[model samples]
Target: MRTGMTLLIKFILTFVSAFIAFDLLLNNDISWILLLSLVAMLINYLIGDLMVLPAKGNMIASIGDGLLAAITAYIFDLLIPAFTTSWSTLLWFAILIGIAEYFFHLYLKKDEKVAP
Candidate 1:
């Protein structure tokens, strides 16, 4: 249940960030933005939240998440011709996601302390 909630939160954050950067700014299609957001969220959750957060602590995990977001977006931009975006846009997107990830990691840590 907790993990589900975490994923939901991550998805919401990722979707909003992607929507702003890809759809609103770059005029990309909503479907592409949605797909990109989903892919980033899942990979970030798996690697950033599950693996790195537990091992390396919040700062490292958040940085990793940001890098992961940028790399994912870059790959999508490369593979999908319609998904046009600049490096600056991708950088901003990664920063937004990274800030959100920092707060998210804090929440998870808090929950860990409260849980048995």
Candidate 2:
């Protein structure tokens, strides 16, 4: 169950990070719009990961999830034009989401290395 728990934590971290970053960077009100966007980003990562489930759970999964997360974040941003989401905003979320996930995964790796 460690894998599952780690995955869930990663998901939550990515969601929260994206939400907070978008809110702070864009200076937008934290409303349903931001919440839904975060959800979309999460969904994108989940679906992309599932699609590559046969990759023996390697870096491919992470790469796919990262790409999808960025796309979904952008799509959701566009889902509401009032947010004034530009390519830079999308790039920010994309890069940060991947970085957040990468660091979280590394934390898990470091623990595994220390474990008996």
Candidate 3:
């Protein structure tokens, strides 16, 4: 149950960040942007949030998500011209998403740490 809720939050955060980046920065079509966001969200949640985060901690997990976002965005840009953006823009997007993911990570692991 907790995992499910965390998943939902992760998905929502990824979707919003990706959607804004693709739609505003790249000038992509709404439908395709939505689809891309969904795919990215799922990938990040499964790999970054669920798998790597618990084992490695927030910084590494966020970096993992950023890398995942960059690679995913680059691949999608290759497949769809409208989704294309400059490398700098993609880097910025990844950074912003990574910061957000850090906070989400804290939320997900709030009870996992013992107080000193």
TM per model? 0.92, 0.62, 0.83
> In candidate 1, what are the lDDT values of residues 25-111, reduced to their tens digit?
788999989999999999998899889988999999998998899899999989999898898889888998999899988988888
lDDT of 3 by residue, 1-116 (tens): 66666666767787777767877777777777677767877888879877898789899999989889878888888898766767876887698679888998787677554221
State the displacement of the C-alpha of residue 50, model 2, in Å, after optimal TM-score superposition.
3.1
C-alpha RMSD (angstroms) for model 2: 4.8
**lDDT value for model 2:** 0.59
Model 2: weakest 10-residue lDDT segment is: 49-58
Superposed by TM-score, candidate 1 places the C-alpha of residue 97 at a distance from the truth, in angstroms, of 0.6
TM-score of 3: 0.83
Name the regions of candidate 1 deviating beyond 4 angstroms.
113-116
Best by lDDT: 1
Query: Which candidate order results from sorting by lDDT in descending order?
Result: 1, 3, 2
Candidates arranged by TM-score, highest first = 1, 3, 2
Reference-based lDDT, residue 53, model 2: 31
Q: In model 3, state the lDDT of residue 112.
A: 52
Off by over 4 Å in 3: 111-116
> Which parts of model 2 have CA positions greater than 4 angstroms off?
1-8, 53-58, 105-116
